[model samples]
Target: MARFVKEIMSPAVVALRPDASLVEAAQLMRAQDVGDVLVAQDGVLLGVITDRDIALRAVAEGLDPLTVSCQSVCTPDPVCVGPEEEITTAQRLMRDHAVRRLPVVDGRGTVGVVTIGDVVQDRDPDSALAHISRATPDL
Candidate 1:
């Protein structure tokens, strides 16, 4: 079992500038096959934008993705965890905040992201979520 967030986090650190258009963010998400991207500037974490944010906050609101900026729709100052934080602590934070993912930060800045699936996979490898988490993403 993994004890720390870094052990199970996806360390890709997909990120974008605040001024980038939502379309650009979506394209990046497609290219990376990720659901979320960190909104940052000068290595400072500003916010997090997720695919759901685009669909619900922008598209559903009739906002033009090509014009709307990522920071405009992102969840600012999101709850974060350190790479060395215990898995249980991360899980608690997620539950408390009702968030499924958390950005892992340290002295080096945003290092990675830890998702509920990661915790599930590490804590219960035989669980359905773990199985789904391990499966290759469908196109």
Candidate 2:
């Protein structure tokens, strides 16, 4: 069987809300040690905000992060992938869009989040592979 995306994704994810302040988002990211957070509202996926978004879009542009909400800086409309999407498709999206993180969703709703590191981990043929083998098949 060919490898799939869900097989290689990280289950532990950090998420946030659109109403969250940029400062709040940054602190949360720092606390979680993650670069981005999946932005959701009422448990539905919306968009994602990253440290880079704050630094490059808000800070560099002289917007006050402490006063601004994640929705203000987050990519208004983010590219998304279903839990069942092909690994090849995901890779293409990341490469073409120049993004590093992607939020994964399933019928039950959001399942986990994946990153470039996740894909690289999948290639490790060890720790990640062990996890991959047990994942529910890609949708």
Candidate 3:
């Protein structure tokens, strides 16, 4: 059977309200051991917040994380993928957007996130993406 996004996705999502403070978002990231968090409103995805967003938009800007809202730093209207989409389509979307992660949505709204790492992990061991994704990051 052909692979699909939902078939390999982690199904673990860490999300927060847009009004949530950057500090709270950071706390959630820490607690969840995730690099990104979805900013949602009433179960609708509004944006995405990554550690990079906090670092560049808040910390580097000298803004107080506790006082600032995640909505202020998040990438608004982020690209998203459906659970039923083909993995190749997901990969193409990632490459086209130059983003490492894409929120997975369906009729139920945001369900999970699909990261390049997730894709790489799910790919065949002999696949080029798997080998490339497995490379260690520099300290």
Candidate 4:
């Protein structure tokens, strides 16, 4: 049997409004124990905001998290994958885009998110992708 994005994707999505403050996004991440949040507007996916983006793009620039909108620092028009797509397809998309996660969407809307960690844990625990996915950030 083939593995699909839906099989390993995290369906409990934590999203932020485009107009939301980066502080709010950060709070959501802390509350959800996640490192990223989807930036959405009226049910439309706008972008992805990662913890790194908040740190590098906003904080490092001395921007006020209370004032910066999620959309302002998010990775806009992010690469996405469908729920039913093969896990390999998601991995390829992640590698090609230089991203660690991909939003999982369908005709209706975003159904979940797939991270390299998810793939590694579910499929190949010994692959290079798994190592990269599990590597500690250089900070």
Instruction: Report how far residue 7 has shifted in candidate 1, in Å.
Output: 0.6
Highest-lDDT candidate: 1
TM-score of each: 0.96, 0.81, 0.88, 0.89
For residue 116, what is the lDDT in candidate 4? 79
- How do the residues 54-124 of candidate 2 rate in per-residue lDDT, one tens digit apiece? 99989999989888889877886677777688877777889999988778877777788778767766656
| Candidate 1, run of 10 with poorest lDDT | 1-10
What TM-score should be assigned to candidate 2? 0.81
| Candidate 3 accuracy as TM-score | 0.88
For 1-139, candidate 3 gives per-residue lDDT tens digits of 6789998776888999999999999899888777899999888899999999999999999999999999999999999999999988888999999999999999998888898887877767667877766676443
The TM-score-based order of candidates, best leading, equals 1, 4, 3, 2
lDDT of each: 0.96, 0.79, 0.89, 0.92
The prediction achieving the highest TM-score against the true structure is 1
How far residue 122's Cα lies from its native spot in candidate 4, in Å, is 1.5
Taking every candidate in turn, the Cα RMSD to the unseen true structure, in Å, is 1.2, 6.8, 2.9, 3.1
Q: Over the full model, what C-alpha lDDT does candidate 4 score relative to the true structure?
A: 0.92
Per-residue CA lDDT of candidate 4, range 1-139, in tens?
7889998899987898899999999899888778899999888999999999999999999999999999999999999999999999998998898998899999999999999799887787888877876776553
